[model samples]
Target: MSEARADIYARITNEIVAAMEAGAGEWNMPWRHDGSSVARPVNLISRKPYRGINTLALWIAAHAKGYGDGVWATYRQWVERGAKVRRGEKAATVVFWKQIRGRIQETIDEADVFDVDDGRPRFVARGYAVFNRAQVDGYEEPDAPRLPESERVAHAESFFTALGIPVAYGASGAWYRVSEDRIYMPDFGRFAEPTGFYSTLAHECAHATGASHRLDRDFSRRFTKQAVAAEELVAELTAAMILADLGLAAHPRADHAAYLSSWLELLENDRRAIFTAASKAQAAADWMHARQRASAAQKESEAA
Candidate 1:
């Protein structure tokens, strides 16, 4: 990298680290199927031989440039430890490069490497496909206190409108697009009950706030399950932040055990990720807060 480019990389990394420290990102250990214990995948370094360009780009943007010596020292420690595992000098709990390659290879041997006409070799990126072990049994639904029905609907409508998106009620719960204009609710009937309805909407509305139209967040494409889990952490954290700001208590959901493994693996592999994700979460939350303020101001003006 050129000196200028290197500087930019460092700056991005520093920003990411700052974000993580502020509760925008979370780091944890990988979970196992037994639900009673956790273990790092054994092939942490030997499995996957390389990193993806997008992952590297994001990492650089979030960590490299502006960090202080103290931060750099911590990062160095992670790298050194990771390197040792990669070199087969250490026994790591998390599986690395080689294991990743083996998993991919098992799915497709000798993947078509290039377009015959273009003569461009296809590049394989690092990602994971593993069993889910994390449990969501302990999570409790959001507390819906005794808010009026009209108030809940109005809140949901305003939240979605601010982001210029449509809401879709689902069977189980709701999900909003961060990259597109889609609202997903698993089963609306299930949530038809007073408390269920608002709680579900609240979750989706929180997602809408992170949409590109609203927060300009980069939660669109994540190659690995770990990366995806990391993004989820950002989303959930952002939701909690919003709920807190609105004087509402946040609730937990189930079925995150599978993601727990990836989440923990990523954290063990990259400490800087915690910082980067946290920063992005905070940015998303700030963006949503700003929109709420703007919307309220517009409403007041209209009334005037």
Candidate 2:
């Protein structure tokens, strides 16, 4: 690896260590819920990545208090209520919401939502919001605009290389790096713009972070539903942070809806998940930033 790349990797590693030391425990995996005892092929939208019990409990409390729409406020309320229940101060209750065309509508359903008085009040739901019911709309564009092809490839290559991950172009805008010399990048024609290209590459880089030689996350092992959610949460947040640092707007994709339950559940289950994910994401951003900086320094050094 080039000295510049090496420096980038070191900087990223340092940032990660510092973030972890600062009590970044929110990355803990979440629980998963299958609708039935028999495992079936579940689509992304229907798949519940977090444990049903914990999630249901949270849903009930939040629903009863009518606090799902506001992201930060809902999270804060859940944490406060969750602590009460955990400490035997309040009980859990399940409040059912009607399912209307993939959207979770607040309704009275005895089977869907119920309350259980265990230590604290706990609420459970069979399922929360479905697709198309809740939409994420914002003032900013969903994705960053495209960049020049050459710039995209150069950026992707430099970004991964700095992390010590060798990636080459592959078909359909995909990227892969199995070994030191074996790396691939997909054809750019597969994507309409550079933002998509970089976003896809960023996802792959996140996977590389878990490589045996690196963070060794071992995603292959069947993670508790929560753990997988947590990792994905880390990946998404990291990608967004990196994208923002790169002077690009990180737009939410359609698939993000698939993890809504898990996201909410993880946050509710662990009050620290948001901060932890943010810190890790910041670490990833620092990593990418350091790499770019190193590259610039090397160019200046050569000029000097």
Candidate 3:
């Protein structure tokens, strides 16, 4: 990587590390946000949610700056929309991965030359500056429509049911047993708050996605402390993404603080660690969504 690219990685990683440290005492990660403006950070024009590291980066920026919404856009995009970024308002950096397009020359028998294509496209990170809606004028942040608590709970239930992951309730603790390919949780009434049940379920379900038959995202082969911490971070971030998509809040679990030190160590040691974890978490969340859609389609087909 070039010096500039390295700087981009280090800068974002440092900021995230700082955010995590700041929140460790309170047990709130950067991604745990109130479902106010929208579930996830989105472009003001494209209406598409930001994914992976960009999602966590924007969430940190929004939290630090006390932004009331998750709408974001480039300066040019804001100007094109006739919205003025307020004077002296700084921008946050979001990285985009662009593929390097070219081929390499290879010699054969010292007589012939061939241009051989690389097996896979190589991607380089580029940073872009974007301002949140709170930093702009002449545009109003839209109110996010919310479902009633009961309906939202039912929606979560239906979503998990569609995925069809087996759940064994009435357990003393919550976890996904990869050995048995099942999840165990206490009964519904045991949770202090209804949202807690769903949030914990999302976390466990994210772990289930890492099963051999699912996303196959096992980091346990290393059998080291850091590896375990990395997998936990992936599951935590994936759960945040899932809850955000469901338009629900991610309440912090009291036990999450145990992994905070390891997470900080990982991020500080390798600048790209956060990026890799975010990518894996995003992939897991995407897999869950795809499975849900496939299941829903199958059900519709059967009904028809």
Candidate 4:
């Protein structure tokens, strides 16, 4: 890996490490948004949500700098929109990759690489700097209606139903039964809040996404002894991303809090661990989103 490319991974991993350290005992990671407009970090110019590591990086910057919304854009993109980034405002790092035929890993996320038909590796990592809307001027926040709790819950139910994963309730604990290819959860009534039920369900669904026939995300080779920890990190991150997209608060699962130490160790030992986890998590979330889209399309066809 070139020194330049390595810097990108180190920078993002270090920032997240610092944030996690800061929130250590409190269990408040940078990804914990207050169910405000900051759910999914989006670009001001394209109006599209950032994905994977970029989302986490922006969330860390926003949490540290106290930004209230998730909108962000490149300095040039802001200028193009007639908004000037305020003087002396530092930019956050967003990493992207370009496809290239090479054997060099180049500090890219391992999960991003694939063998083309010709058997050459694809992808080279690059970084971009972006400023959040909070650091810009001459722009106005768009008005978006917030869904009520009832509607949010209904939507959450529909989303999981669309995935078609068999979920068994009344279990003593919440977990994805990989052997049975199903998810087992405690009864919904047991959760202190309705949102908690969905949050936990989202985590299990993320785990289920790794089924052999599904995303097929395997961490054993890359993580070695830390494979389980890596998988947990992926599932946790995936659940947080999904809940944020659903416009719901992402509460930390009590069961997962214990894994914090392992996560820290995994990230500290490996510069690419977080990137690999984030990439797999993003794939899982995208899989769920695709299912939702397919189900919606099917329903519309039936109605038509």
Candidate 5:
């Protein structure tokens, strides 16, 4: 990578690392799920979700400020929408890929190549500032917490159902049966707390993502403290992410909290472990979305 590109990557990764370190100390991190909505931070300008590292960056910012809504906009974008940022509200930094002018190293014919390794092509990350809707006025928030509990559960059930995993209730513990390719949980009624049932289910779902056909997360070298800890960390991160996607609180429970020391040890030993775990967790979430999109396409095909 070019020095410029290396700086961009290092800068983003370092910021995330710093946030995680700070949150771990304060217990103010996303793991606290606390039912805070992790809805996509949409750009008021385009109504499109921010991508890649920007998503995590904005999420950290919103959670830090206790922003009620995930809506965001550049200063100009808010103005264009006839909304104004409240004075003194701070802005969060985000970045996007911008292409520099000029193309390079294209061969006009199959036989025409001079060694053109020195040619320059420029694509770099450009930074900008945005304010969450909580910092703005004159525009109504789009995502109000209006979904009722029963309805919310219904939606959650439907979304997981599409993953096509068989979930069987009635076992001593909640777990994914890897050998049988099934999930087992204690009866739903046994979960006394409101979020317990969904949280347990989400954890199992994350484990299922490691099956041969999905993310293939090999935890085969188990029995060691580190191996088990790493797998648990992945599932914890995965459940938290999916819960956020479901607009539910994602705080850590006893199970997720139990491994804090292990998690911190692993992270302290390797600076990139958290990022690797996050990327893998995202792949698990993407697997669910892939099923969702395919199901939609099939329905359309049948309708047509």
Candidate 6:
């Protein structure tokens, strides 16, 4: 990797790691906000949502600056569209992977390297500067009408339901059963707040990412006390990601306190643990969220 690419990776990992460390016991991801979370940031010109680490980086930038919307564009992109970024407004940095010619090295066949119809190219992460529409003066914000409260709840419920998981409501302390491939929760009426229910459910859903057929989280098979703690840490981070995506408040459960010490210990032992856990947690949440749409599309295709 180029030195610049390496720096981008290091900088992103360091910032996210520090944020996660500070929020160890608090159960808050740095990107979360009090109100509706911004949807994934997208290129206003291309109409494409940012993906992977760029998604988290832009979200963190927006949350920090209190950007009210998720639309973003390069300074040139803004100019192209006859919009101007307000003077003194800072740009957010996002990285995209670019494919380039592979480097040549000794002990490898030069012929083999060029054998393909097109020479094999290696992907490197490249960073770019962009401004959110909220930072641009002339750009009018898009109308993002929210669903009604009842419909919003129904949407969240239906999204998960279509994923085809067996969820049972009861007083089982609210957890995903890896052994049985089931989720247990208190009855809807028992929870004092609906957000609390979703919070707990989101955390458990994060754990489901580690199932053997899925992300295959280590603790799913080992089940050691330490592994369990690590897994819980993953779930906590995942819950934060999900809540941020759904625009729900980051309200961790009362039992969140129990994982505080474990998290601190884990972070202390491994400086990069938080970064790893946070990235995987995002992946888990993304998997679940993406499945919601994929399931819907498949059903539509089948009906046709």
Highest lDDT scorer: 4
Q: List TM-scores for all candidates, in order.
A: 0.41, 0.40, 0.51, 0.52, 0.48, 0.48
lDDT of each: 0.41, 0.44, 0.68, 0.71, 0.64, 0.62
Model 6 residue 72 CA deviation (Å) reads 56
Q: Cα lDDT of model 2 overall?
A: 0.44
Put down candidate 5 lDDT per residue, 1-304, tens digits, no spaces: 2355334334433443454555544222212221223657778767788888888999899768756456778999989888888899889988876644454354332323334444465555667889986676676434433224443377677778888898886443466878999997655544444466776788789889888888888744532446556676677766665665676653344344443443677777766676666667667767776888888788899999
Lowest summed-lDDT stretch of 10 residues in model 5? 27-36
Winner by TM-score: 4
Q: After superposition, how far is residue 183 of candidate 2 from its true place, in Å?
A: 6.7
lDDT of 5: 0.64
lDDT (Cα, tens digit) per residue for candidate 6, span 1-304: 2355334334433443455455544333221122223457778878778888888988898768756456788999988888888899888888666555756443231223323335667555556889876666555434533223452376567756765667876332466778999887655544445666676777777777788898777853433445666777678766655654565643333334344444567667666666666567666766886788789899899999
- lDDT score, residue 254, model 4? 37
Local error of candidate 4 at residue 7 (angstroms) = 20
- In the range 17-62, model 4's lDDT, one tens digit per residue, is 4556655453322222223334778877777788888888888998
Question: What order do candidates take by lDDT, descending?
Answer: 4, 3, 5, 6, 2, 1
Kindly list the per-residue Cα lDDT of model 2 for residues 1-304, writing each as its tens digit.
Answer: 3455345434443444344344343221111112221222122232333344534554544345422221211222333323111222233332243333333334343354333323443343343322110112111111324344565556555666666566654221233444653434444434556665565566556655655655555433433557766666666656554554455543333232233333566666776665665555555555556667787788799999
lDDT of 5 at 103: 49
Q: Report the poorest 10 consecutive residues by lDDT, candidate 3.
A: 28-37
- Per-residue lDDT over 1-304 for candidate 3, one digit per residue giving the tens place of the 0 to 100 score: 2355334334433444455766655332222223433468988788888899999899889878656567889999999888899899999988777665456464322323336466666555668899987677676434533323453387788888887799997443467888999997755654556666777788889889888788888665542557867787777766656665676643334334433554778767766667777678777777887888899899899999
Each candidate's number of clashing pairs is 46, 35, 0, 0, 4, 0
Ranked by lDDT, the better of candidates 1 and 5 is 5
Instruction: Using TM-score as the measure, name the better of candidate 5 and candidate 6.
Output: 6
Model 6 stretches astray by more than 4 angstroms:
1-152, 219-225, 250-261
By how many angstroms RMSD does model 6 differ from the true structure?
A: 22.7
